[model samples]
Target: MTLTAADVPLKRPTVLVADDEVALTDSIAVWLSDSYRVRTAYDGHEALREFGPSVDIVLLDRHMPGLSGEHVMARLNEMSANPQAALLTATSTDDFRSEVDELGFDAYLTKPISKTELLGVVSDLAAAASESAQH
Candidate 1:
């Protein structure tokens, strides 16, 4: 039986990791590379340059030099096919709940984020995207 593209499983989610923390961003790309098409940007401007319709989700920091994460998120929301986004910030949940709620992010993850937690959310979104694509 020849296995074609159709026989393969779901498409890997293309995730944009946008954070000013170089180490954290690189580590996440390394961790998720095998399971996802991961992209990284050191700051908001770079993230905006790299982001496009192909990206399925964005893991964005709440603060960064030049354009801030919230600004980037707002711009992204303006795109016709906006990608799902999550706030990956060090800000306390209580501190940012109202702000995040206003932005309508797919998730809000505080910093020192565990690999398990990251993977869990990504996997869930990936599965949901795949399911939706099938219909």
Candidate 2:
């Protein structure tokens, strides 16, 4: 039997959640696992280790130890992975908006984000990624 696109299962988009807060990282992972392939990293180094071309979205905490989210993002850019990244941070500085833009983040969300908000952003990013991939 010839398998058409409809006959094959579609691959779920991968989301990488990186935060120094262990609880937050695990919780976000659990929340996203139902809809997307979720990968959790407790630090910036771990985040880079888990990241690759397969990642469609990245939810990164801006203030991680050893290597900040900005550093990770820069490195990811160097690696040529075209994932949509969101900065999930507690920093709400006046210049944060410009910083996020300058640093190349697709979105910036200040923490204590609700599950709804997180899911919505991920869903939107995933959809955009899918659309871009088709082109």
Candidate 3:
């Protein structure tokens, strides 16, 4: 089926989610389908390959097979228009939070994140993206 403008989540805000967990990727993609143009990548290499450098946001995991979350965030920051990213990890650490933020992820959501929180965050990001577009 072709996607209409109304079908696109966050309007023009395309989001990329890169993680090694297939289940997590599928679940997130399903949850976010109604509101965002969501894409998934199983690893950092795939993330780099698939993610538009101009993508609006990314939900990245802290650990993966080859390239760590830190590494992906590092590379993203080097882009001219760095996409906003959030860390999703089952294990929460203050040190990790510090490190993730240093890489400029917009937020760090602990894993097992609720559907409500995910929707809410996406809503906020969409609004932010809209406002930015107006300016």
Model 1 agreement with the true structure over 4-69: per-residue lDDT tens digits:
989775567899999999999999999899889999999999999999867888888988999788
Off by over 4 Å in 1: 1-7, 131-135
lDDT of each: 0.84, 0.88, 0.78
Pairs that clash in candidate 3: 9-35, 9-36
RMSD of each: 2.3, 3.0, 3.5
User: Looking at model 1, which ten-residue stretch has the lowest summed lDDT?
Assistant: 125-134
lDDT of 2: 0.88
Q: Candidate order by lDDT, highest to lowest? A: 2, 1, 3
Q: Judging by TM-score against the true structure, name the best candidate.
A: 2
| lDDT (tens digit, per residue) of candidate 3 on 67-119 | 87778888877765566668878886676567667788777778888989987
Clashes of each: 0, 0, 2
lDDT for model 3, on a 0 to 1 scale? 0.78
Best by lDDT: 2
Provide the TM-score for each candidate, comma-separated: 0.87, 0.90, 0.84
Q: Any residue pairs clashing in model 2, and if so which? A: none
Superposed model 2: Cα runs more than 4 Å off: 1-9
